[model samples]
Target: MIRDMAKGLNFPEEATAFLGECFDKITALEDGNDQLALAMDAFFASKDYASILNRLAEQTGIHRYSVDMVFLLLCADSLHDIYYIKELPEELFHNTMMDLKCKLLECKALHGIWGTFVTDWLQGYFHLKRYALGRLQYNTIEFPYEDYKGILKKGDRVLSCHIPSGAPLLIEDVLDSLKQAYAFYPDELRDGVLPITCHSWLLYAPHYEVFPEHSNLRKFYDLFTVIDNEATEGSNLDRIFNVTETDDYSTLAETTTLQKRFKKYLMDGNVMGEGFGILLFDGEKIL
Candidate 1:
């Protein structure tokens, strides 16, 4: 089951077991103190994420923020709960599950999924975050929106046809939609370079004895194979860049496509903060 999921994330087959082992090892080390060790998890689980975050911030003297550690570990611990994809076809199920789990595990998962919910938004108005000298806007695009005969008003009426993503959404699909927006606003997207990011839930493998922060690590370093290399262009080619397996990313990270794809992340705001990076292509590449 895990192998299938790891495969979907384009993760290595071997590391799936190793990651499970890591979780088990963490669990074993926790021993009888699991509850105490996971106190932060309890706080966040009870919707006190903000309060705990504040408290942890004030305690600068403390090293090794156990609260934060527990939160992410809890995320890892719960990575396998995929009720949404359970009924999907076997071939389609694992990838879907991995995609969703990865999203849920991402550090900024909540804000990236929905806007930073706690921010003040009066009269149905809210400000979105941005990145890269305003070159990148964070999670500001609603998958379904106006100017393309979008509903214009939020209501029951559906337009643009909704589809259940039984797998991770494709970069090509994202680009297609982005182009639609580009068609509407040409001046803003001047020079054909529009950089939007896509991220997935992935617990990366070790890098120089360090894990790359264990979140969505896709810079789509391999996407050029599809976008630049015509032979690779197709329906799910974007997913070929999914770093699902642990060591899979580390190996794929070092490839002919490395320059074509970047083994990197934004200094900030590729999405909310961190742990949400997949494909954030530059304008020249797509347009």
Candidate 2:
């Protein structure tokens, strides 16, 4: 049940166990282990990699503490999804994470402050928002785009709105887009494709959500999904051309076997309405 709470997230069984151990540490702290308690507390509170490292460094006498364990904790906390983690012994895992961290730091030193860290922040925000939806048990629509509707401009900012369907997103087009982002931010992709899972609509912005299944309240549900380090519960829809209540959203009115169910839902006038989609992009205009 715990494993299944996380669907889209992928990680090794040992790493999974390690994550559980982390929670257990939280529990056991009440029994004893002062250093462990303090260190873990700091880690849980850390918002960025630099802060995370600094917190651990501050506690020199942490009993039974290893840099690798902290590294593992940081990675797990930062990415939310541990699927990309290499299943290695504690020493090796720590070594790998440290290498990545040091590289990122070095990139910052050479490329100035905002190079790689900003990218991490963006991807983190993307996943965090998706996790929020998953927490509500919101099932996202992962549909395909075969025709030219419109393409989303790509960058690092949390999308404020869903992009409208204009040009059809072909398979090649999707791959090319992913490739470009990967090329632009190669270091972040070292673990694999940095995930970008958002709701059909931009939930990060202060908007309204119609939860007919649960309530009639129109409240903001656009919480960043990455905030939940455990990712034990959340929803995320990441695909080439994800559908939303966006621009010309009614253009999806053409009922077909591919997305008949989704189309019917959109047509139902329930959770999603038409033309509420907004695509987010930064940097390159061609993205």
Candidate 3:
């Protein structure tokens, strides 16, 4: 079942094999050690499962990433349960589950492992707090900006949009996702307005200096009414370069135009950071 789940999530063959091995080791360990068995149960049931799993990893001499993989696979076994309960579309389930694969790849790229530290974030999917409709992932969040206190107010319910790494964020695909979201969460809309919010490095205003006006990313940035921009040192480097270490810019590869431009921007002592924005979706278009 674990292996099937791995394949179904489109995990690479090497990653799938690693997950199978971890699952077998976990099964054997739990079967032989009653205390370990109890801890495994607690991991599944407890909200502080990451800490528990970290302790288990130390006790059993298994890599932390491997422990996380076993836990994720165990969670994957019941993926359909949430879908059934939420009455979410099957396509959304598949699209959302693909995030698992993306994060696994990210882990391998960043740490050379098939495990993830973002399990807490992944919990949103299993706990029914997040969903992927098309090109974007949407989750309910409190309006976090102070600029819109009168119009929207802090703590007011809003749809937080996230861009999952994969295909290009074509305008058509993004529009389709927004259209789907406006329809899917009718109860959340007020006066046919779906308040969507985003805070990401992609929204960093200085990208305008790096990205051409016609670039998909630029187009994405244009979709929002940016409210704030603040310097967050090194936030964009890892995502853009796929390398964890960011202190030394000379070692980074300049394989793409954006990378070359952004790398030069950094080498020139300029910092890149995230921006906060809101998109008012009026059921049909971004208003």
Candidate 4:
């Protein structure tokens, strides 16, 4: 069953198993008394991710940030409880490569289905062709590392819609809806970032955006692919993208498409987020 799901992702089998192992180990908490101590250790160590990336670059002949992004994505996928492919803003996934590693230390499983969440709005707004090479804006949070877990919660929704909402939302309405949708997330959908909004109408709402902190990682690196590429011939691609629904079923239909496509992709392909990387080379290296 696992193999079937990993196929669509087109990832190496060894990598998938490695991630599964990491997920299992973290969740198998025999002791809960050391949560604070464990968190302390992780917090300090996280600051060195950049150094770790440099070391890996020296060892593997890859750029520092490129290797870091891959490491982050791998760590994120390894610890998540679900996976899905969708468009998302570049800002939200800013530290996604680093944030995923942080998430694993705490052992939280991410969740989301395949394609039941795609729309025209998601497509145009969250394209890799535009944001992959952009600079990511940074912010100071209350608990940078501890609160990192919440990043994926935002990521799941962003990827599903292909839109980045630039600013973070403390909207009470969306959080409420997320509570219900998440409870019903399936058993087979074992791992990656998952999002559930507090707004019921927004669950499959036609037009919504992911809070800036949790957009797709590819966007952060300014990466684009032939698959997500499009010709932007004088269109307002930069304006705040919104999806206006013709009827209630518009979002429901989009969500359904996301589900059907994700199932087939997982069953027949490799794991999501384990695709070809764009930052494989530094600016000086020859392709």
**How far out, in Å, is residue 15 in model 4?**
14
Using TM-score as the measure, the top candidate is: 3
Tens digits of per-residue lDDT, candidate 2, 128-173, equal 2321110111112332232212332233322222222223424344
Model 3 Cα lDDT, one tens digit per residue, 1-287: 77888898888999889888876766676442453455446544654566667676776677887677767776766767667777867778888888888888888888888888688788888767898889999899888765473558877888899998857889899999999999889977877788888999888888777875689989999999888899988776768898866679988889988889888988999888899888888877888
Best by lDDT: 3
Cα lDDT tens digits for candidate 1, 103-216:
323313322221112221110111112211111112334322222222122232211211122333354554555454344334433235433333322212111112222212
Query: What is candidate 4's TM-score against the reference?
Result: 0.22
For residue 198, what is the lDDT in candidate 4? 17
The pairs that clash in candidate 1 are 9-244, 11-244, 11-245, 12-245, 102-201, 193-283, 194-283, 198-278, 221-261
- The parts of candidate 4 lying over 4 Å away from their true place are 1-45, 77-287
lDDT of 1: 0.30
TM-score of each: 0.28, 0.22, 0.92, 0.22
Q: Which regions of candidate 3 are displaced past 4 Å? A: 31-46, 147-150
lDDT of each: 0.30, 0.32, 0.80, 0.28
Better of 1 and 3 by TM-score: 3
Q: Cα lDDT for residue 284, model 2?
A: 30
Ranked by lDDT from best down, the candidates are: 3, 2, 1, 4
TM-score of 1: 0.28
**lDDT by residue (tens digit), candidate 4, 244-282:** 221222232223333344334334432232111111112
Better of 3 and 4 by lDDT: 3
